[model samples]
Target: MDSITFRSDTVLSDVHMYTPNIRHLMVRLNAVGQPVFVSKFRILRNINVCSKDDIGDLGNEENRELVGVNNASTSRVDCSNTMANEKKDEEKKETAATEILLDDDGDLDVPRRPSDFVNSCEKDLWREKVYPTIISKGEEVPFEEYDEDWSICNDIRIEHTMDTTLEDVGKQIWRGAFLLADYILNNTYLFRGSTVLELGAGTGLTSIVMATVAKTIFCTDVGEDLMNMCERNIIVNKHIYGAAGGEIKVRELDWLRDDLCTDTKNPYCWSEEEIAHLYDYTNVLLAADVFYDDDLTDAFFQTMYRILSNLKNRSITYLSVEKRLNFTLRKMDVTCDAYDHFRLCLADLESINDGKTKFIVEAIKLTFPQFLFYERVEQLELWKIIAEPLISNTQQ
Candidate 1:
């Protein structure tokens, strides 16, 4: 599906195309086996393309190309059961919609469009919503083209189209969520019986997988609508991961504020009740693809620092991100600023380098158990953050 559309009026080169109409850039690549030469390439997400009213970018990038590119006969993600249930559900909705238009309120001979659906029950109301698609039903992360027989499988639910408001990002499960979830599944022992808190847990995909192994999971984001969607997915999939003998609870955590201090007196700060109920039990933190821009990067680290500093016992945070570089025709490559800011914040906490009795950030070299289930996007990396490691992090 060469649907990778571009703005008609933007500047174009032999290998690159600029679409100022959207925030993301697009590059036309050579064939799979050809050795193509280009000045540079970057995985820049065009945030404002589909979501006109929304701000901020998303992950996984609707790589519809990869989805349909895989041979249908040998694809790993089995969507048979998923499609059957959906077909039946759609049929029911279509039938009910047809009946609504034939009622005494209007003429019966005309075919009514969906917008013509009036007096619908709450369930049938056409609110701004997204339909679920069967992209990548959870399989073991594939190692090579031929790897098979994955031990664990997760069926994920995601939206086909979503609004781009800051809150709407929670509608779909991004690639970062899949990568982090794969890490948790591979490192299941570390999370056993531990309380895990997920920040920016869009759609609760990562939390859903973590819930399968951890004692408890607090799925948090910014808005009520997003939290409701997250909670709905958790509840809908309870039998699969929820039955892993853990519970998933949703909460609102706006990380943009400067109120991440330990002071309980300030109303803007985290409430004492929230700390006692949720944060107190948390010993591990999880975030994926949360580092997209500069402001978000600073606030995210501040939230992490506030929590690590307030805690009496040492805790560890696992952050997974893909460094997105923006390469332009002028040979100027712009990268996500969050990556640099995170490095600065982590370096300042190094005991030997900065001499601060604070949290330490280290890069863990983990190459085993490659999760080939989800599409491994460009330059994805995993970092480890610990408040106080029992052993010195020589890797740092």
Candidate 2:
């Protein structure tokens, strides 16, 4: 046999040495007559080494007489023991390396399993840092804010800032949008291969989620800055949607601007072609936290009516609002009577069609503590409305 010393330092130190229950050894042999480069051998077992020495006679007189010679012998024994331990360690390291190599090469027939403790630790880490930091934040902050920390299935993205201003109020994503998106994802099959339009899409969280599920999503907010931010968020998560074969566009859509829906002179305005395209592809309309201001209620409903009327196919409109008592009271206190204005608009629409269009509203109560209460305390109402071509044939 040709002899070769496999250096213990090169292979043994890099392998896992503390793994219990099994031991592995690798041997490489070279034959003078063999035509091949090398031959490899592997051995695996469950074995341990132990010392067998008697120590009960340490206090005997005969032992005392032999103590001097015993002491010298003790030193030699200690040296030998140390050498033996070093040799064993080297051997173990080599064995570990061999096991790893064999496993990598698919030559090791042992089934490797992950330790349960490691998996549990990973789960605990995700629950502790990922859930509270990313998933639990309310709707006012768009879902895009958590893009970097979490993976979104669609192309939708969000950008957020700490800046709070009246003009930028429409930029904030409400928690209700998250709930709406979750509901749609879990219960409805309305998103696939569809073009979706999200009105008053604050941080565009719902749009982001919808973008993941829809063929295309158009996320709109009222302000220029908010629209820019929405676009920025979309760019940030562009890759995510690309991978999923979906797309998202963030644009400014002012419900108060009548020109937005009709002006042909302005490029940013909703042109006739765009309107036709919207009517053709859009099957679902989503809105969240849009009913807070009583002043915009009429214009909001009119816009919704026009959009719904144009769709050739039946469209499902999901509108969520936090029913604020303060707003109702404020409108009542004011001479304008905002609720009355809204009711009058609804009544007018109802009178024209004899309630041909269908509206279903359900109130959802949200839980929050008083001290941490930043969002207005209000009951959320989700409305599912079906638009009818003619008001006369609509069901009440």
Candidate 3:
């Protein structure tokens, strides 16, 4: 059985656009002719009063990883009664999996209004012959042209991948970013005029959103290509925060490294002044959906400790993570080890009493108002860590 399919002609590009109204960016094909388009995350004006009649339930399967864009298709394999029939079905499974076979009778409904948000439930519905169309780019785009209204003041335009590998997941938008963005937008007083540092700020979406309210934002992540793309996003979305005089400095920060990159020859290296400002002035830290691998989770906490312990003022770190469940052959059941490890790291940090600094962990309730338009999942969580230095007798 062919379980995995690979596309060999994928090419990444940096050609992105931003218009005056901040809508209708041109979708450009990469070197391999794959379409790359802009994903606009609209802000919900009144989520409480929004009509639930049209909005369907977004369960765990629908909101897997709670990422902003879900590209995977779901297919169900039916077992035949006879061995000959089973063999024939197996032969055609590959082709059937790739295409949306809505019904056994081959009947499809009239295409409805386009969906800006893509989820897994729609894919499952297609397999069950209950849905009309998938709203994502490629193969099934409803319109010939890309004209849609995004004149809303709070909509966030992000450059993302129509197709991506597991390694390139950071280049896409995640729902954790939306959760944090909601918290930031709803509780503006917590970050108003504050110097904020966002670790693992992939695509700089959260940082860009934060810049609209915060005084200064340090959007830090590794990889030259990824950082360049993030800087481009910061440039594209500058109009949202530029009028308010909010500044976002895209810098390179590797979680595995103990020291900030200070080499003057490097393009994304940090300056002495910026480093000082980070340790002295930054009062808040933010991270969204960066905890997946065990090794990286360990490195992230270590880096957080180093930054929080040396801060000049009492600082708080807000972390957002979607508890991802997967079936492991070893366990033979669904598990969420990465999220468990993250909770373990939080416990260790809170238990640390080295006499120099203190760490306190708290789980923020998700009762905050929704600002961005996305399928909010229960697995999506927000955690807060408050770090304060302990004053000794000599200091007192």
Measured against the true structure, the TM-scores of the candidates, in listed sequence, are 0.55, 0.50, 0.69
Error of 2 at 68 (Å): 68
Better of 2 and 3 by TM-score: 3
Q: Model 3's lDDT to the true fold?
A: 0.65
The lDDT for every candidate, in the order shown, is 0.50, 0.45, 0.65
lDDT of 2 by residue, 153-203 (tens): 222323343213445454444546645665455443567888878888876
- Model 3 lDDT tens row, 67-117: 222121111122234533533443233223212212234332111111311
Over 4 Å off, model 3:
1-26, 29-35, 45-152, 392-396
Clashing pairs in 3: none
- Which is the leading candidate under TM-score? 3
Top lDDT hit: 3
Give me the runs in candidate 2 sitting further than 4 Å from their true place: 1-157, 261-273, 327-378, 390-396
lDDT of residue 323 for candidate 3: 95
Query: Which sections of candidate 1 miss by over 4 Å?
Result: 1-154, 159-167, 258-274, 328-331, 334-336, 349-357, 370-372, 389-396
- The better-scoring model by TM-score among 1 and 2 is 1
In angstroms, how far off is 251's CA in candidate 2? 2.8
Residue range with the least summed lDDT across 10 consecutive positions in model 3: 13-22
Please give the range of 10 consecutive residues that has the lowest summed lDDT in model 1: 34-43
Predictions: Cα RMSD each: 19.9, 26.3, 12.9
